[model samples]
Target: MTLSFFQKFWSVLANDIMAVISSFFHLGQLLTAINHTFISLIPKIPNPSLVSHYRPISLCNTLYKQILDNVMIAHDYLHFLNGKHKGNNRLMAIKLDMSKAYDKIE
Candidate 1:
């Protein structure tokens, strides 16, 4: 096995991530530092010109991502938002959590 495989299988990383995720549920808290993500824009094809031709992806630490994914799965937010509505009019819903919005300002 490679070093990375050994590290992942034997290290305390899994425990640490579970602890963080547990705190998120029991205490309703998340680390502010982990919320910051680096967004990178990659071109879909060579010699692309338009903004739509680029795909944007968020990059974060693997541990942070795993915790976030767990939380999302528990909440099932995407499943609710993606459900079809039977109507001629468009249905829309917006969720805004501004608990620490001001802290994001420079």
Candidate 2:
């Protein structure tokens, strides 16, 4: 079913899920499945040899996707503002992937 359908018909279920997510976050608990991901390498050229010739992408799960959707809204607004800036003003937005950094911390 579409997102709109879910929101219209299963609003309570949606709200409950959000509440659960909020509670889990407040308690500093995260599900292992949310951290689990599969990395796939796709070749950029037909005859690829070195790792640089391929691009590695992670196939993330639903909860991660939901988090990204919210984050991307902010990014979208930053992109729009950067595009609309006039005169000598320059707007810069930076995106950093800190997941690997988090994994290394004890």
Candidate 3:
């Protein structure tokens, strides 16, 4: 978690990382510690004209990211990315009005 770790690792090739890992222990859940989250707006250009130019950055605990990644995998959110499985029936999406989609998201 220190800047020196990242600096030294990239500076040399045969650095021994075992010394840093020999003192590690299991990090069990601690609910009392407040989770810190902040949204950073990354502008695509030096001068932005629209909201589309902004990118959102959400940072959270490492364990929280691991849990969320597993949940997304279980839901098959990107199952259509690979063409390995063939579908028997054609799927159709009927869109009525998508302009005001975020008005009633809850």
Predicted model with the maximum TM-score:
2
Could you arrange the candidates by lDDT from highest to lowest? 2, 1, 3
Q: What is the per-residue lDDT of model 1 for residues 1-106, given as tens digits with 9 covering 90 to 100?
A: 2336536685656787678879999999998876777877878899989999888765665555565566677468656656745676555656666545422211
Clashes of 2: 0
* Candidate 2, residue 11: how far the Cα is off, in Å: 12
Ten contiguous residues with the weakest lDDT in model 2: 97-106
- Local distance difference test values of all predictions, in order: 0.65, 0.70, 0.49
lDDT of 3 by residue, 1-106 (tens): 2334445675462243333233232344344322555566778788998988877756554333455566588456445444334576544334356446522211
Question: What are the candidates' C-alpha RMSDs?
Answer: 11.5, 10.1, 11.3
- Which residue pairs does candidate 2 place in steric collision? none
TM-score of decoy 2: 0.41
What value of lDDT does candidate 2 attain over all alpha carbons?
0.70
User: Which residue pairs clash within candidate 1?
Assistant: none
Output the lDDT of residue 72, model 3: 82
Error (Å) of candidate 1 at residue 41 is 10
Model 1, position 76, has a per-residue lDDT of: 83
Residue 32 lDDT, candidate 3, scale 0-100: 35
